[model samples]
Target chain A: MNVYIIGIGLIGGSMSLDIQVTYPEAIIHGIDVSDAHLEEALQRQLIHQKATLQNVENADIVIVTIPVHASIKIIDEVLHTVKDDALVIDAGSTKEQICKSIAAHPKRRNFLAAHPIAGTEFSGPSAAIQRLFEGKTNIICEVEKTAFSLQEKALELFKNLGMRIRYMDPKSHDKHIAYVSHLSHISSFMLGKTVIEKEKNERDIFDLAGSGFASTVRLAKSSPAMWTPIFEQNKTNVIETLDEYISNLQEFKNLMLQDNFEGIYKEMENTNYIKKILKGLE
Target chain B: MNVYIIGIGLIGGSMSLDIQVTYPEAIIHGIDVSDAHLEEALQRQLIHQKATLQNVENADIVIVTIPVHASIKIIDEVLHTVKDDALVIDAGSTKEQICKSIAAHPKRRNFLAAHPIAGTEFSGPSAAIQRLFEGKTNIICEVEKTAFSLQEKALELFKNLGMRIRYMDPKSHDKHIAYVSHLSHISSFMLGKTVIEKEKNERDIFDLAGSGFASTVRLAKSSPAMWTPIFEQNKTNVIETLDEYISNLQEFKNLMLQDNFEGIYKEMENTNYIKKILKGLE
Candidate 1:
């Protein structure tokens, strides 16, 4: 089997590593815009060979793991170049734009839109690690749009990587992800910005940051190059989530100002249900 | 040596475990209002004995690890009861109020105002773990007010527990903590509240929550019994931090509305300095 992965950064690079283990007999090819990333992927043995769009013609499977905007621009081209029977998947965080771009394509049945719900705050090829997808959720949007045989092959691959699959329409996927994933990145990034701006003394922040601050601000360390596009692509949903978040903060502040400790405590107690919801992710 | 820990929950319980390891010969006595917690602490063997307020009279060292409001109400009584030579310390998140309340007490010289900058989201005796303070920072406020010998003993104890001590004025400690620690908790709790409110389908949230969402919302799981009094005690500083945080979010929303992708990218890129800051924590 021949597998070609384009934009080989954290997700693409990590997928390459896991796929190599799952399909040892398969030949892997990588395409990335950054020469440095390609070099790191090679040194890391994430790919057996480096290839471009023209070289993916014979590929049995092509996976696009670039930034969402880039994925939207290049996914249709990838579909056009791959073999008719080949399977193509795009693992972008925001799926609506990418899925819409190829909805009317002649090779639409050969493409699948997936968002593998996994990652660290770090980025780049060096950030890739084995077992990243193990026991993680992979959301497949517009699954009915993909050819049945190709969907089966994709399912086999996801299962081999130890991922559980869930299906949703592209629009629902974007809305849900905007709340669960994209908004989290924004909140964390803004938190980091607020702290850095208010507490000019970096040493004080370093000295006082406990595990809570570490966990809450961890996402602020994510790649701007990747997340900026995600926020832009899902702007409406992201903004809606952000507005709700800000209103919640405002209400909390009002309760604090009014000395309504009971109200504040109740708010947090209500949200404690997140503890149970997040247990599976741990 | 006799050490009495009042309110043996996460912080106090964890401290008892570490202190036992550091000073095996010392007798550790615990006092908590919750019988269930006291029972759990005893079952976990976190204390050598259970004690009342009268029992603390003979204590050579008394550590108050209760909620900040309770700490303010009871610290004076604990000070009045302990031996003249006893080194009394309170490990509350907000230091200004606690320090101010005891500033004029005759036994003030025997007390040390300290805030150990460490904790997990979980709480109670069950959450207690050995080495929780290892390689973490412990801030000592109003150090000059503490008796020289008592300060030395406290420093020795913190050192034995593998904590690095940094000194700050009580006001400065509370202000800094409000931003670095308290604000993070608020952001996380509010984020959790917003997402929970928006995503009615708990299953969707459970299935789609990625590592970033989990990290960003981890602090929401913290015990409300512990945090409510903290917000009450640090109201002014916390409200100020919340205002700044909300304004930052509003600005980011405006930028998103305008499709100012470059502005959003730069915000996250600048906060990426947190990567360097948090590395020290790990």
Candidate 2:
């Protein structure tokens, strides 16, 4: 099988690397606008060769893994050009926009909207590594729109990547991701900004930053290029989640100001449910 | 030297384990309000024996590693019971309250107020392990209250544990830590709360949670018993820092609502400075 991956950054590049490692016979092709990244990906052997948008026409599978807005545009362009038998999948965070963009495509049956719940703060070809998708969840939205054979092909690919697949509607996918993923990026970015603004002396932040700060601030290192579009595309849900997050923080602040140790203790105890939930995932 | 640890939880147990590995001749005595933790500490061999408050009086050095409020009470209690020349040190998050609690004690010269910037989300004596303090910063506040000779002894201990030491006023220590450390815990706990509230299905949280959420919410797994008092002790500073964090999120939300893509992009782009800061620390 020939796989064409657009935007060979962390997610896309890692997927390509994983596919190549697991199925050595599968030919991998990559497409990226950045000349330097494409060069890096080629030099690192992340792909068999560099391909253009038109090259996706020959692919058995075309994966759209660009920034959210760009992913929508590329998916439309690929649908307009690819073979009817080709399976086109998007690994974008927000699904509603892309699902709507291709809702009326003549080759709509060839497309599948997927979000493999995996990523890192790093980006670009150098950030690519195998096994990034291992033991992770892959949420596929609007699966009924795709042909049965294509859906089977996509499922096999995800299974080969060691991912568990689940189904949901595009709108629900956006809402759940807004809560679980997008809001996390915003919280991390703003926390990073607040601390950076507070300690003008970078040395002080470095000296005092423990693992907590590093973990909480990790997502802030993600690509602004990728996340800004996600925040914009899912603006309404993102804003609502952000408001809920801010209100939670404010309420806790009020409890602290009143020196309500009991209130603070109870609040944290309630939130400590995350431990059980996290362990349950494994 | 004989070292008596007041609380044998994540901090104290980990310290005792590391100290034993690094300094074989040093004997570690354990004390805790919880009998379970003491029993676990002894079972883990994190300490030579479980002892009582009386054990603190005979020690050459006593390290009070307990909650913020408990540290104050223990400091005052130790100040009255320890030898005139014994070094009494604390490893609490907030220094101002603990420092002031022992300000006028006759043994103030022997008390060292320290905050080591290291910990994991897990707590209890079972959570302790070797090398928790390696390559971490240990901040000593209000060193003026400690005798020069006693300060030398405390600094020697931290150095032997492979920690770089920083000296600052207690007020400044609280203010700086409010942003660097305390705010992180609040952000993480609140993020955990927001997600858990949104996704009523705990299984969805575990399934959809990626390394980003895991890293951002890692501190949410911290013990409420350990953190509740910290929020109460640093109530004023924590509330102020939390207000700043909330406003930062609010501003980002406003930008998103306004569809101010450039503003949102630049905000995250600028916050990416944390990467450089973190790299410098490494």
Candidate 3:
């Protein structure tokens, strides 16, 4: 089996790690915009050989894991180069834009739009780890748009990577992700910004911050290059979620201003139900 | 040694677990408003016995772990009953109010205002675990107000429990904690409310959520009984922090509305400094 992985970063490099272990006969070729990333991936054995977009013709499987903005720019050309039997997949965070952008491509049937919901706050080849996708959900959007045999091939690879597959329409996938995933990143990043801005005045404020603050703000450490385009592509949905979130925070502030302790207590009690709901999820 | 723990929930129960192990000869007497909790503490060996506020008269060390609102009401009474050599410390999240409440009490020297910056989202005696305080920061407010010898005694126990001590005035402690601790809880709780409210309309929204959402929302699972009083006690500082937090979110949303991807990306890049700051912290 011949596999070509574009971007050689966390998601691609991690997928390369798992794929090589699962398919010993599969030759992994890495393609990246950065010479440094490609070189590092080779040194780390995340890929077997360095390759490029032109070399994709030889691929039986091609996984594109670049920024969503970059993905839209090249996914058409990637589809143009891959052979008829090849199964191409993208693990971008937002799918609706990419799926829509490639709708008219001649080789569209070979491409799969999947988002494997897995990551650390770190990025790049060095940040990649084996089993990154283990027991995680892989949301495949517009699966019917991909050819049946190619979908089967990608699903087989996903299973080998220890992932659970859930299929959804692109619109629904982007909308749902705006609430669960994108909103949290914005919330976390803004929280980090708010606190750090405060730190300029309050020396050693972080010294007193415990594990709770750390956990809640951890996602602020995510890659801006990656998330910026996600927010751009899913702008409408993200804006909607942000409006709701900001309003919620505003309402909560008003409750405090009004000295409504009972209402505040009730809000927290209601949200505590998240504990039971998230029990088996982690 | 007689060690009285007056509130056997997560914080109190956890301190009891560590204290008993540290002071091997110390008999831990658990006090709670609930009999079931006391009975559970006995069965779990979290405490040697159950006692009430009146029993504090026999105490050499008294630790109050109740809600901050409750702490202010009962603290002076507990200090009145403890012996001159006793160190009565209240581990409440908001220190200024409690500290000021007991300021002129005759037994003022016996009181220590402390906030141990440690805990899991879980609560109750069943949630108690050993080593909870290991390598965690214990913020002591108004330390000089406590009797010097008795302060030394409590400091020794904190060291034995593996905590790092940082001294701050009660006002600064409450102000800083309002930003680091309380603000994060409100953010997490509001985020949880936003998503859960969305889930009511969007079926299976959470299945698409990943570890990021879970981590960011984890604190929302914390007890309402524990946090409501905290928000109430730290109202002014929390309001200030919330104003800045909401304003930050509004600014980000405005950037989104204006299509200022550069500004958005720059904001995230700047806040990425949190990655380095929080490295050794976790």
Candidate 1 C-alpha lDDT tens digits along B1-282: 999999998899999999998898999999999888888899999998899988989999999998889998788998888888999998999988888898899999999999999889988889899999999999999999999999999999999889999999888888889988999999999999988888865566568888889999999998898899999988999999999999999999999999999999999899998898888675
Q: Which stretches of candidate 3 lie over 4 Å from their true place?
A: A201-203
Residue-level lDDT for A142 in candidate 1: 91
TM-score of B chain for each model? 0.97, 0.96, 0.98
* Docking model 3 quality class: high
Model 3's lDDT to the true fold?
Answer: 0.91
TM-score of chain A of each: 0.98, 0.97, 0.98
Q: Tell me candidate 3's fraction of native contacts, as a decimal between 0 and 1.
A: 0.84
Residues A60-112, model 2: lDDT tens digits:
99988899998877888899899889999889999999999889989999999
Worst 10 residues of 1 chain B by lDDT: B197-206
State TM-scores per candidate. Answer: 0.98, 0.97, 0.99
- Between candidates 2 and 3, name the one with more favorable TM-score: 3
Clashing pairs in 2: none
Name the lDDT value of residue B147 in candidate 3: 86
How does model 1 do on interface RMSD, in angstroms?
0.9
Per-residue CA lDDT of model 3 for A217-278, tens digit only, reads 99999999999999999999999999999999999999999999999999999998888668
